[model samples]
Target chain A: MKKQIITEGKIYFPLSETLKLVIENIMKRLTRALLTMSGIVLSIAFYTTLMLTASALKYTLGAQQVISEYYWWMLFLAFLVSATGITNSVLMAVAERVREIGTLKCLGAMDKHILEMFILENAFIGAIGGVVGFIVGIIAAIVLNASTIGISSFFAIPGIEFLKALLSSILISTVLSVVMSSYPAYRAAKLQPAEALRSVA
Target chain B: MGGEASYAYTVEVEGLKKYYKMGNTIVKALDGINMKIYRGEYLSIMGPSGSGKTTLFNMIGGLDRPTAGKVFIDEVDIAQLDAYELAWLRARKIGYIFQTFNLIPVMTAYENVVLPMIFAGVEAEERRRRALELLDRVGLLKFKDHKPYELSGGQQQRVAIARALANNPAIVLADEPTGNLDLETGMEIIKLLKELNEEREVTIITATHDIKMLAVSDRIAWLRDGKIQRIEKRSEVRFKVYKVEG
Candidate 1:
């Protein structure tokens, strides 16, 4: 015998039903994040490519500048630190889940669910990217820091917190990016389902 | 209040007045419409362009409020319901099927159908069971994992029907559900709706401009210029036809 589903006027579906919707939605956002940041990623790759072949090869000041403003390879690494990749990845991820955002509202997803879904989706994406991006950025930075540039200097790679700081900085940027893009997500949530369901193209 | 009939109506509306201020002209979308819909009936609402059929449908679905009337569903005066209560009412009792078959494109067939239950705060296992069961009933168990774009228009409409029935609501408010489908597919969909009406005693209220819908409806409230021109029962239609011929 199937149990009575409704008691006291509340109707319930399975918990995973909503969770799966949310999970799939976040995955969409994550894909978008990857796309949105591809430019930045390409820029980093391009800049690294240039740095690898620059005239500063063999100069300490040149390499320091690479660490400072020019490449500031530390910047991506830094942002990834607190939770690196979070900001960029979250922004991209939420952007990707645009349709899901509107659909959830139509399904009568309350403000909290919409908010939690986007935040959690991107946060999960960020967390994943944070781990991976932090590791990669560190390796890149260390390779940049310790390797022979166009110029050479006595190089020191800290064994511990250097890694922590690098991870932390990346974390900050990821967080900042996520915070910045949340308004867009909320705006997407605020759209009338009637209007939002229209062809996005 | 409208005059009482012998039987209680599952839906009742009175003095419904809704308007939108478009620049200087106030569009009186629904002006003083009093309507009652009975249970275990399949009804269609038909009107020409600008006749406010969709507007009335929207009000009935609780997607919007009537600016100057009360909408009562199952005896609760919905106009008095707060935003949250309205939301709850929508989630619990009313099932809406749109003209476009607005299945959440992001979700698979299984997830889309159970969406309302999630909003109403159902548990996980039960919703999954019900969603699959409905999908199975609709003969789409094999296609449960497919997304909206992956399905044909007919399949999508079926999915929309399953979604509408997600809450097991007594009423289904479908707005031109077959408008986007081809003739053969549209007829198939009507057949499905008829089957549901016969099997479950579910009240189906469809708003359409198509003459085909009128043929399938148990009764029809024909609207012209936002006012109901006539309300005709199927038997009444047959009697009228015979009288005109004989």
Candidate 2:
């Protein structure tokens, strides 16, 4: 005896099982998820703050000529470290769930389904971290710039610069997350069901 | 199609061989074995620890490819199919039960039961209905919302059984299904499996060392040293069981 979820000719609130699985998986590892997010957050926050400070100082000190073009190297380094962090963390998560993947395979789940779950999980993590990092980075940039120069000078800085920094940080974190997860996702998809069972047995 | 029209067996294995290469030596897990399992038959494969019973079970379940042989399930030659075709066949035809009760730890019993249905493209309402019925049939309806960690060993195995039956598969392949449970709980599992086999006429093939399973089986296949030692009808299988006093 089960309650009917459909009314009339239409169904009410039909959710795909994959979406539920992805959400449940992420929620189950909230502590590890948060730890993984912190890496992205810290990296993006540093990148934003550095960019904002350079723009603010350019106007305040009228020293645009003194700004080094090699400053982009620091940003590149931050991006590389953050991408590596996401890859390692997602790989560890996949390693712990090898048997679960095998069970899914035995139950008829295709490689694409397993791949989709991992990508979606990392994308969500990246988005949340990016937004939070943007806010924190902007605030830090404003506070430090104000203390270094006068509050009036800080307010004089163009709003466009902050918007650019916001978009950059968010885009970088989200894209990095997806790119970094591909290898581990492929590895998970390629796992043989029998071998996976033995790994945990 | 003409060739398949004459076969009466649901699963037909011919000259199946599986060998694993470890370092420099090749271990013959299943050597030149052949088997035929008919529809609605309860067959048990019994053997000691390294006797290749599991290897045979894997070959029939489409979980592993044999070195030199063919497995035909429901008239389709599985060895001829590619990965995609094999996945489709496995999803639509076979249900697997493992000793470790491989239910997703984060999902509830109900969700675990409906997982295979979801893979088979069953709609939400139908999937829910079937999952509920299977859980109730397996006597795990009361624990539908519980996670695997929250359930007892017997309860978890019951959940796994319910999950196995979710897709209404052509066959259920159980590998040492009672290996991890107590004797009393194992008996309960056997009773449930027996009821399922009789009530639904689902083909049940189990690989195990548990003598209790032999009682309920229609045919028992004994394997030793990578070869089938003997196959006996249930009426011909006679063995003594002695209880150990604690």
Candidate 3:
């Protein structure tokens, strides 16, 4: 027998269930997911390459060097472009899934759950892009500086400093992706179920 | 009307109105409509494209707010509930089926069936058991792992029907459930819904353009120009099919 209808309290999916959905969604659209992650990957790789090259140079020369401001400005521009790309990609994704979102709403999903799903999806992409970009940057730095710094110098950089750079790159990419995805996520969550259902494609 | 205090009506709509403004003119989608639906009844709302069947369907499902008036589901005014409470109501009491068979494209048939139960916070074990049972009932247990795109239109609709019954809702709202199906498939869906309605004793309300639904519906409400033109019981209504001779 069906239970009596009661209107009280909020409905929330368990985190494990939500994570599974996020993973499944990403996996199903692997091509689009990879396309969206490309912006993060390229930008993070560039940023990491610049930072690692500078660290390698400083370590090889045994000098405390001050990086130029123009480099910082260029890095900022790269991130700006990457953020724009991610935001545009995520917005399109939300628009494409308007009907899906409506179906979810009809099945009793709250705005918060929708928000969490999108955020987690982008965060997962960000993490993957961050790690991949960091590895690429590490390889690029080694190839570029190996001949001049005698290969040993590249590895001679302090372990703590190398770990710090990796952590920072990952943190930056993840934060950038999340921040960029917020507006699209918010728009998706605030969609009225009725209008969303009526939307075409 | 007797003075008995029995709450036989499962849904009630009072003085409902919905208006949309298109530039200088106003379109009254639903105008001063009122209705009462009994528990365990099969009711069909039939209308043309612009007759506001979808609008009234949305209002009753709590998917859209009315311009005025009240919608009482199980004697509670839906507009009075907050967002969280409304979600709870939708999750626990109402099941909706759409013409397009809006199962999650990324999920398999089994996952789609289990989704509503997840929102209703059913235990993992119970959800799995019920999902498999519902799949078996729908005669799609073998195709449980197929995604929406992999299934045929009829198969997808069956999956959607099973998903709708996941949480054991008291009311199932179907909007053009057979709009995308052929005559044979549409009949199969209608029969399945009829059987489920009788077996589960759930209130089934459908907004459709299909005249075939009249055979299964206990009561049929005809809407025209944003208002109920007439409502008739199955016994009182008559049909005539005209065949064209070449």
Candidate 4:
């Protein structure tokens, strides 16, 4: 048999297929996915609650100052903790799937594909967490400020400001998730197929 | 020598060596191994643990780089290819079956079979059609939607075999494929592999301790201490069955 000459072969995994895979994986591991998202959800909820509460107070009382420097520092620390949590969760997930990674590599998945899958999965988790946190934060803000600012003041809070806060929180959560998970994703991509297959994970 | 050109070799390894550094000492996993595997042949590498059977299997599959020497697949030196080209070679030419049946846990049997085709850029319609066809071929079409964990050991291995044949690869490398199954199931898997090899004319190479494989293999390479001790044609080999006296 004469051998065919080598030529560049195309690797085509459509974005839709990748997204479907990511969603299926997240759904199948719903417990772990929820656990991993908890940190981001709490942190973003705290952030949105603080921001919305400060805005409502300023709008109702005409106060020159609302949010304190201490609260800002607290928010920063919360974000740092959540980011670390995301990294730890993703790394553990990668470790648990070492054999799967090896099999994917054997099936012709490039490093870029693995990295893309991880990032996309985490990013989707972050987005969902962000939205859920925002809703929780809104409700909490309204209840916490009702006695001081009254229910009427809650309605008076500018809609644009609320929208901005919601969007920012989502952006922060998504960006944080991607940035934190990048290292774990890179490690996964760099795994040697032979060694990974040998590992009992 | 005059008829050398008549023989089509799918894989050739020359002076292959793999070494690992353990503390201050060196472990020679594979030392100066050379071999040729013909097209459409059923070959088995028989050896005990730490005898470098898996190491050699990995080398041939392009899953590992040798410390020295070269591996030629279809007359092209694999060492000369870049990572992209190597991935292409693995995707287009070689299929792998593991002892553990490493199908993606999240995917169903059908999806598992379709994955390699997706990576190879096959169209969606074609992927679905071929995936169904291959699963039917492995007698797993009814269980297409079942996940790996839901299947029995033999059934899962069957799914894996379907996945391996998805891309129509020229060679299928099975590493201890029957190591985890019961005697009956192991024999069935071996027989399935033999039938596929004959039907598709795909070169089948397996590394295993299963003596049952000898009945199907055209050639057997016996490895010991990181070297091939001998190569024997199926007809040239014999086995002695002994009964234990209580």
Candidate 5:
């Protein structure tokens, strides 16, 4: 009455399910999204604040040290916060998935499979949140620039430097998310299915 | 047993012991328990609170390492496998149904059922097919796009059952599956489980305080204070099963 067990083929193969589950988590993350993303918001705000301060200094004092300050430094700080936010969200999600993780383990999911699921989900989260955040960041920067420098500042939209900046931000966010989330992903993967199910909040 | 044409049992739990530390005190959840469940067995593990039904289930599922003893499934000792090996085994070999339903509140019913197969790396077309099939099997295909909040408790548990069987594991270990449901809904769940066992030959191990489940079980292992106080045969031993009114 039942199918025979022959497990030579992949049981935990389609990476999309994990991605799908994570995306669902990300969507549900909205209520607490602000809280989860506080680190990101603060980092972005800090970098922008510093940039505004430096720009003010450059205009008023025209110091050589101010001239030497690169915009990349500001972007780096923003990227760090963004990466940390993604990593934090991912780790928290894994921690919440204790029973589900245990269920997966009990159902014969491999550790690598579980690990792959979390990493894939986190990476997807990074992609969705990072890209959206990058777009939002760029828009904010442009709007501020426009208000400060007048309509002429709108020309910066199609500039080659603008495209490059966007690309770099996305790249940085992706790298930051992946690198930061690896350890937590590994922890989720190494969890024992049976023991994990017994865990209570 | 090498080159043998048959597996010894669906599950072989032998002298398995597990201890938990509650602050400074070590609580023995299971103290050297042993069991053998053959293929197609409709068994209920009945126990009072603090009994080791869950712990025993955990060890067999490879979610916990025992303080002592071995658990074999399809001739493989689950306790012997390392973490990665055990994970792989679980993904392919077991179907677990929990009393809590436990579906992610945000995802649709389709997504919930597909979680197991998705983890198993089934291809896109096949995964979709299987998810749909499973949803239909649980009579939730029409509710595929709906989230968990939209469903009733019984519906959610049905979805959980579908998810558990997603990988089509040899055994289904259900813990208090009807504990949260009303009498009518609980009876419905029990009927559905019975159908699954009969039609699929999926060995069912239900842990519950539900008297109906014990009444209809092939065997009922009554547990008290972390020990199997009595094991009774309801009808034909080890899965011949007792008939009950639908």
Candidate 6:
């Protein structure tokens, strides 16, 4: 007999099964996953380092009045490049696993389930990459601004400001990762299992 | 079961047609076909490469939509169901075994078998128990922890069979189950499938080119040019052995 439970008007998979599948798939290709996530890590690290350097320069050069539109444009450019990198990596992942997706579908996975798998996989990558990037960025920021702020002064930034910066950087990276992977995840979800099987062979 | 309209057959197809557009010309993969698969019977569909055997199997398994037809699995017309409904049908009623032994490469044999149960949302403890039992049934219990690459082709196919039975599906659709195995291993797989048919009364529909599969089936249907050419009962099908010299 078939059993079903609905919560908040949506079908739910058992948490244990979902976690197992996600972890197994990710671990299966650890090297590739790490390579893909490196793109996000590098991009976020670059953006964070640049922003921190600018902040230190603003204080050292007494340029508080020099806040300008070009700063925002540069930030925009950094974010755009990161998004493109994430999209490329995610789309390549989808292409590589067409057969795997088809196999899941044949085992009774719905489009929503497939989409959830992809999104959750990338979200994990984002979380990890973001935290790693923030850690590296902090170190880079300190090293680059040591001459201007002095090593001791660099460590004296207000606790709240540092916390705020850390949280913002991680949040932005995670959000960008999700948004960039959305289209590719949707494409993976929309694949026909039969066609996907035939596509690979 | 009491409220639903019932039929003696596990699967029924009426006026099935599948056409593919290839440049200017349309290829008729399955054209104006009709068939019924009775409950608990072993049925084999034999055909040439382009004869639409796989297409027919796809329609019955709810893996593909027919351009013009109705596929009734246990009296419910599958074509009328939405994607979610079709998924439920697949999970609850139809199991599939592919020719290439399509086990997820990274998953252990046990994990592969448990996957269908997961999709069906079976309880964790129950799923594990059933998966192990199924592995034992297919004589692959010892290989439960091995990944697909670590197993022989025959062992991989056994794992696939165990996976197919994970959800206790009413019908198992096997497309060329023995096509990739050696002669002895192919025979063993066929015997195991026959045992499943006889002991559990699980209806089996296999599409294959293997002549030995035909001998074991309760009935065999031959197809050519997208149509059923003939269907013969096991006793009526005459098998003649021939030797070829290279």
Best by DockQ: 3
Off by over 4 Å in 5: A1-7, A32-89, A120-158, A199-201, B1-8, B121-134, B235-246
Error of 2 at B6 (Å): 9.5
Fnat, 2 decimals, each candidate: 0.29, 0.43, 0.70, 0.63, 0.61, 0.42
Model 6 chain A is weakest, by summed lDDT over 10 consecutive residues, at A2-11
lDDT of each: 0.66, 0.82, 0.89, 0.89, 0.70, 0.81
Q: Which ten residues in a row have the lowest lDDT in candidate 2 chain A?
A: A4-13
Per-residue alpha-carbon lDDT of model 1 for A25-112, expressed as tens digits? 5564455656544433433333333333332332434444333464465545533443334344454444554545544554566555
lDDT of 4 at B106: 95
lDDT of 4 by residue, B74-94 (tens): 787898877777777777789
Q: Of 1 and 5, which scores higher on DockQ?
A: 5
What DockQ do you compute for every candidate structure?
0.23, 0.31, 0.53, 0.52, 0.38, 0.39
Q: Which prediction has more favorable DockQ, 2 or 5?
A: 5
lDDT of 3 by residue, B112-222 (tens): 999999999888899999999999999999999999999999999999999999988889999999999999999999999999999998899999989889899999998
lDDT, candidate 1, B5-36, per-residue tens = 23467788888888888999998888888889
Model 2, B128-229: lDDT tens digits are 899999988888888999999999999999999988888777689999999999999999999899889998888999999898897799999888888987
In terms of lDDT, the poorest run of 10 residues in model 3 chain B is B237-246
Arranged by TM-score with the best first, the candidates are: 4, 3, 6, 2, 5, 1
Off by over 4 Å in 2: A1-15, A58-71, A150-160, B1-7, B240-246
Models 1 onward score TM values of 0.76, 0.90, 0.95, 0.95, 0.80, 0.91
- TM-score for chain B of all predictions: 0.90, 0.93, 0.95, 0.94, 0.90, 0.94
Q: lDDT per residue, candidate 4, A1-201, as tens digits?
A: 544325445665678888999999899988878887999999999899898888877788877578899989998999999999999999999999999999999998888888999999999999998998898889888888788777787777899989999999899999999999999999999998999999997
- The candidate with the higher TM-score, 4 or 5, is 4
Judged by whole-model lDDT over C-alpha atoms, candidate 1 comes out at 0.66
Preferred candidate (DockQ higher): 4 or 5 = 4
Per-prediction count of colliding residue pairs? Answer: 38, 0, 0, 0, 23, 0
Better by TM-score, candidate 4 or 3: 4
